[model samples]
Target: MNKQIIDHLFEFWEQIGKHGNFLTKENGFSFAKPTNGSWPNKVFDLTMEKLDIHALCEEIISEELPNSIAVPENEAIKDLLRSKGLRATSKIKAMTLDTTNIFFGNIDASEFIKVGSPTEAELFAQVATESFGYPVDPSTIGALVDKPGFQIFLGNHENAFPSCGMVYLDQNGVSGIHMIGTKAGYRGLGLGKKMTQFLVNQSIENQSKEVYLVASQAGERIYTKMGFTTHGVLESYSLSLH
Candidate 1:
């Protein structure tokens, strides 16, 4: 599960880089332009080998959370990041759920959800921005629609598209659920959970054996109730100088 967690992240970025015009990837690092600054651009795959901290620090252009790196949860590693003038901004749980182990008592997430369409990238971005209070470029999600191995969905309620989520099925049949969000006005209605369930259901339908995500504190409870177990922790770091 740990290896899958790391590989899925790298592959997910690879898919995004393949279609995002303003995004670039090299080795385990990826970047988004300032215009698409709110996009999740970061460094990952640190467990495979030796890390070149000096070169990595040079690539960091800001101290913001968006300009972050995904690193293993280790005291020594975190101390090293801080020694290089970086700060630990977030500690998130890396969770995993085997599809066969799920037990959704009665929460039916079968609400109407539109499969991602290439023409609706702007719509996806619109819902995402409204939900997150951040600017998410259309291309940030648009380039992913109609893409293979990725199943994106828009949740509809009361004739409004206020929620969206995606499931990325990696080559090893590991599904990663990401970007599950509902607009501020539409939250507290269990829409977020529904979107997550919808993504998980899609993974089961596609024959993905395991599902994973790095959950925020709020999302951790929801996903845990959905049968996901915390496998480990992942910390995000950003250079102090920018």
Candidate 2:
């Protein structure tokens, strides 16, 4: 796995901490309580090399009540977790945009709106929830309004708020697309692709050397058409309480 992709994912979760509670220790154990029924409310970076896997799993089970554990795919860790009774529940691809040659369908720049205030941020969150079928804390979106290098864009189709996208640019010149979505009724309207292109263009304007994202299965094709190639796989494991 590319280190930049890994770091960007970690940074994405770290920014989620701004809205609620997030903890990352030097030992590499980290967790966030985004309270949005989102992936941020789980454990991350759990490599057995950094901590005792059994003890860590037990601790998360007892104290953290972790909904999942996300880590770069590793056969050793996967086998060990399976041996310990955990199973991978899902997998998402980590992809990087080919910044040198980006291509997206034509979209009028006027169709998208920049999310700059709390009210607009909340609207963006609502669109995300409607699109992804998961709760997104509006407070979390609002919190990013003032965060440096975090930008959110919302798309309006037929006078309705139907799509939203976010981009995070770290000081290290790595930019990541996050939480991009279009409402169920808005699918096939090219809103998502437009929002993505808007964010990518913004990142390029910010002088980002790399742009990446963890793409959902449904979103893989959209990104693929935009010249994003799979760089790695991130496996998500769920602990069976029973």
Candidate 3:
């Protein structure tokens, strides 16, 4: 795994912090959007080095933030989290794609549209929540798209929004695909793949040299088939207040 890519992934989270409150310390950074019902309202890019886990956990608990952390998967961190009564919630694959070798399946390009305005952002968020079985605030989505180097693409089938994906391009030419999803009813139509390809294409056009994403279990197969290979794992832990 390239350390540069890993660092950029963290930087991507920092970029996300721009739309809301952000706090950075020696060990890590925390983000929160109290008005936005999104998952990023928690700490990320955590490193246990030179830090006090107990104090950090207490601070998070006292602040009433989501007791969530994303860090590299390892026994030491796991044990530390366990000591704090945090349990693993998910193990995400860190996958990268060779944007130059990306494959685009046979899908109508006309069905895909670039999300640019608040209305389109709302539609994209709605489709993403429906596809991924999660809740996302349209205002957050809209604010995100308004940032530089962020692009959202949506798939419109039969004049209805069914799938969506996003790409982040940083100044360092690092790109990442985030929140790709297709509605359950429209799964077999390959809209997810199409939306992914569209984002990849956008990344390449933006002069991004490398593109990556944290893949969910269901998305691992889709990304692998599209020429992405797993480079590392990110473990998510949720600390129990009790």
List lDDT for all candidates, in order. Answer: 0.74, 0.77, 0.74
Cα lDDT of model 1 by residue, 18-122, tens digit: 677555645534544435465666666553246667667766653322458777756776777788888888887889988886645454565645566655778
Tell me the tens digit of each residue's lDDT in model 3 across 1-242.
64555666677767766664443544544545345347455566666675578777777778645567776756787798888788888878888887675535555668788888989988987897888776777877777876887887888888888888888886677888888888999889877777877787777777776788888777788789878888878877887655
TM-score for candidate 3, residues paired by index: 0.87
| Candidate 2 worst ten-residue window by lDDT | 18-27
lDDT of 1: 0.74
Q: List candidate 2 stretches off by more than 4 Å.
A: 24-26, 36-39, 101-105
Residues 1-242, candidate 2, lDDT per residue (tens digit)? Answer: 46678778887787677445544543646777655455466677665778577776777678654668776766787787788778889888889876765533465778888888888978987898888777788877887786787888888888888899888887687789888898898788777778888888877777776688988787788788878888878888877776
Write down the TM-score of every candidate. 0.85, 0.89, 0.87
User: In model 3, where is the ten-residue run with the lowest total lDDT?
Assistant: 20-29
Candidate 2 clashing pairs, residues 3+ apart or interchain:
none
Off by over 4 Å in 1: 22-35, 47-50, 62-66, 74-76, 101-110, 115-119
Total backbone clashes of model 3? 0
